[model samples]
Target: MGALLRGLVGLILSSVLVTSALAATAPVGGYTVVKAYPHDTAAFTEGLFYRDGFIFESTGLKGRSFIRKWNLETGVSEQERIVDSRYFGEGVVDWKNRLYALTWTDEIGIIYDIDSFERIGEFSYPGEGWALTRDDKRIMMSDGTSFIRFLDPETLKETGRIEVTDHGVPVRNLNELEWVKGELLANVWQTTRIARIDIKTGNVVGWIELAGLLKDAGVTGTQDDVLNGIAYDAVSDRLFVTGKLWPKLYEIKLAPAN
Candidate 1:
């Protein structure tokens, strides 16, 4: 009887895995890449933000992490500052005239003067950091999991969190976030999708698949080069997407599914 019960449980687990694979393989809605810009190959871009008519980007990896200011028109890094080899910096955001950056495993975040890149203060977090975004009121953070938390902009204290899901199941591996038009745009690591999630109710409202974009860009990679970075131009309201170590960042527009 025990053997039979074990067999039944194994069957159920296999069924669940199969169902999840199918759901992930389902055809995506509609998306088109409008423009592609050459991104520096040396930068494993972690954090990307648009401010004051230029792009501010941060790169990851121990012994090589750096925050730099890039000229959007020329794609040239004008100024940069590297972090110590011990810290693997992840997400970054500009808040209240300061720049806040999260570390990979130290469970600490650092604040810096936006113009000078000088460290001002540090705070603690519960888990490893993955991505950061803001909605004018609070800072949104992800820790390579389905849950996204809102932090107090001034104190960096957690105020609330939501477990992102699709059809009542946890959506794992959520990374690299951007808040645009009251929606959360997330890059699901190792996948060809950037999911648009609703913050209030934890529902995945839609997704934009990057199959065509990757194919066009000649991105041939097994894992790390999957869809990752996302930034939106607030003044123009245009969306941009890219990957880790990716050669190009594409400006895109979403179309209704046919």
Candidate 2:
């Protein structure tokens, strides 16, 4: 069943403080909040994306895992489907009108019909699943490591992988993902940094340092409640970010670091 000992796993993985020297050489930047939207404080958001005027999210935790469709105007989830209790839900993404979701230790991936939220199929993978994002043809997955695995959308099987490196050092703890422009943006777990990576070369091209964002928005949280979610609206050119258990989501624009 791929049961994981939460405590032991936490102790090993929660020390996500490793920072590569390569990150020090990359261009860093900050954010400018264009708008703030209400967010469910109870959501431990693991995956996020925008589509058809709605925000789709995947929330984690063993018993509380769920995939929900959110109203950006109201910040309330209009519909949700719970994950099986045995799984700790992780990242989610949409491809060809179908939604794909991953579970942390269960090695399981669930596929659902976007309109009906009906479970249609399942696939398995080795190791853990941290987050998912897609371009036009393929799905990219992160497994809490330096590498991003590429999967064939048709077969949902691994096609290739690229190890993210800053300068030359491997950068780990990549979590939530989003594809913006032509680069892959990855949220480095437990930190306020988002690495903009070159997909083909796996080079960390730049970094978005988002420190003090929650405080600027007056949202409070402990160590575990961290910056973890990111979504983008390609049509409107809007970028959104939020955190685990955060009470607000911010639509932001990137401001190059001075």
lDDT of 1 by residue, 1-258 (tens): 999999999999999987885475322576777888878777787888878767777778999888888777678887787877899988888997899898888999988898888888899998899889998899999999889999999999999999988766678988888999999988888888877888999888877777787777677646566667888898998888777788887889988643
Q: What is the lDDT of residue 250 in candidate 1?
A: 80
Question: What are the lDDT figures for the candidates, one per model?
Answer: 0.83, 0.91
Candidate 2, clashing residue pairs? none
For every candidate, C-alpha RMSD to the true structure in Å = 2.8, 9.1
In model 2, where is the ten-residue run with the lowest total lDDT? 14-23
Off by over 4 Å in 2: 1-24, 219-222
List the candidates' TM-scores in order: 0.89, 0.90
